[model samples]
Target: MNGLCLVTGANGHLGNTLVRALLGQGHRVRAGVRDIGNHAPFAGLDCELVYAELLDSSALDKALEGVQVLFQVAAVFKHWARNPEAEIVEPNLVGTRRVLEAASRAGVQRVVYVSSVAAVGHDGTALDETHWNTESENAYYKSKILSEQAAWQCAEALGLNMVSVLPSAMVGPNAGSLTDTMGFLQTVRQRQMPFDPGFRFNFVDVRDVADGMIRAAEKGRAGQRYILANVRSSPLSDLIAAANTHTPGYRQPVSAPRWLLLGVAWLQERWARCVGKPAQLLLSQVRLFHNVAQEYDITKAKNELGFNPRSPEVALQQAFAYLYRQAHQPYEDLPQAAVQTVSSSRA
Candidate 1:
């Protein structure tokens, strides 16, 4: 836990924050990225930047050299792509295998595979690490499930010590690009979403997830998985209300029935396919909202890894502030009165 740590996808939202966390803990880090020329994200950070394309064995070898811990965080996380098999699933599945194999070959002491709650299914009850998402049709969810499975298989085969951490919908500051979850929040804030489909999500701050990953590397049982998410699921309305409280004046979209939303999503997908672009509203997402419960049981993580996360409302407020700053808008801190109002409403 003391030697050089290599973080793949180091410029990503979670990866960047993880690197900062490691650095703050007085650990040397080798930031692995696809484009070494894009140093803007690592500006002023004292870490070695290496090119690490997950599929490239030579690149992985070079990046993993002398690294005691490896955080495999790179993946193609897209819900709707031109070809899900090629753009999403293949990279996630194959890339995970390649990274684990390379880490084993390079003699990395510990590996923390960054998985998602999408891999852990729900059944109208709070899900734990024991649950597996066996019914998701979403490409992104499928990729996470397959990739994590591959990671464990490869680790066991290679005798490598690896731990998997499944984080729920992550939202926090220092996002280099707008991820799908962040895009959803942005759409809601801008009133671009036509209506709320009553979707629920287990939200967590990216920083808390990063800390949880570190804990996994330090003390997690080999081949075990931990759920790093909020203790409870929150409705989309809660997120909207939080945004309204922090940054008011955006009109709220009316709630729509599930069937109506599904129909609209189908039409949107058709139009998107005809235009050769990614659909803003995916049918898989609608189906998931209708089927799976987003609640989670983080007791294992809490007791084992000492994972303590802030409230989802606080995460939403930070995300809203970050998004507003990204747009060059003046964002004032949530007033004490507004905070009281929002807290009372939630209670």
Candidate 2:
């Protein structure tokens, strides 16, 4: 498997990590990004950087040519949009279809579509790889579910070998603005936990997820979805505690009931609508947060793809260290013992 591999969304958090992982495995990687001019991240790396947008068919075809494996990681992820049909659904679903079609035409041997756990519908405490999130009204979650379905449909229609890896809440170094995982962490670090969102969900290190994506491409079954999630779920309070260990002067997070949070979310959504901006608190987010009783099952991934993720504590520490450095703090000021603990948990 030392052939050329194309990773879409190459500048993204997961995609950036995947590009590095693939390079480490001695594979020739073509980093597919929307802007080839933005080459700072891939600097000094032995990989080709190419411009490829998900909505652009010509770019997709060009990127797929001579590629043995395709890692479809580009998606429009956001809680709210001015026009979700154009900004979110069209790009995710239609762009996914375009990539699959181009891959089939180019005779790519394997494709690892990077989906999310949001695609897996939750039935109380029964959410797993088998569940499909068909009931979600959230644009981001719907895009993931429909885009994945489209990928499968294209694979079946063209007889292509495609596998999907669904990752849960991802945390680690290099989390960009695409998701709120790090933003929530920063909020806690700033002692800004005005109210507890009452959310508990699984989390996995982005590096572990990148490794899992490669493993899925190598060994996952065609048309099957593997959950690249953590074995444990961390609540907001627990995450704050974990951060407090590394962050100095961190305040413990406060709590609020689910009903009050829901009402606040509703008001926030209304305010966002009035101001023509995405809401920090959306009803869909609140609903999803409320549906986290059981952790997502990863036994299938472990048994089949040899996926074993580190604990959330390691991810939290890594994130804290990265953020601390990003804040222009001196390296000597960082918690050395905590950093060593995080480095040891990278297996």
Q: Which candidate ranks first by lDDT, i.e. highest? A: 1
Cα lDDT listed for each candidate: 0.84, 0.79
Q: How accurate is candidate 1 locally (lDDT)?
A: 0.84
Q: CA shift at 96, candidate 2, in angstroms?
A: 0.7
Model 1: CA > 4 A from native: 329-347
Give the Cα error of residue 104 in candidate 2, in Å.
Answer: 1.0
Index of the highest-TM-score prediction: 1
- Estimate, for each residue in 1-347, the C-alpha lDDT of model 2 and write its tens digit: 66889999987888988988998899989888876655555655677777777777777777777999999998876768868778888889999998888898889999999889889855446466988877557888888888888888889999999999999878776554436777777777777788767777677889999999999988999889999887667777677777777766655556777788789888988888799987877778777777364367889999999999888888777776676666663232322221001011111
Model 2 deviation from the true structure expressed as Cα RMSD, one decimal place: 6.9
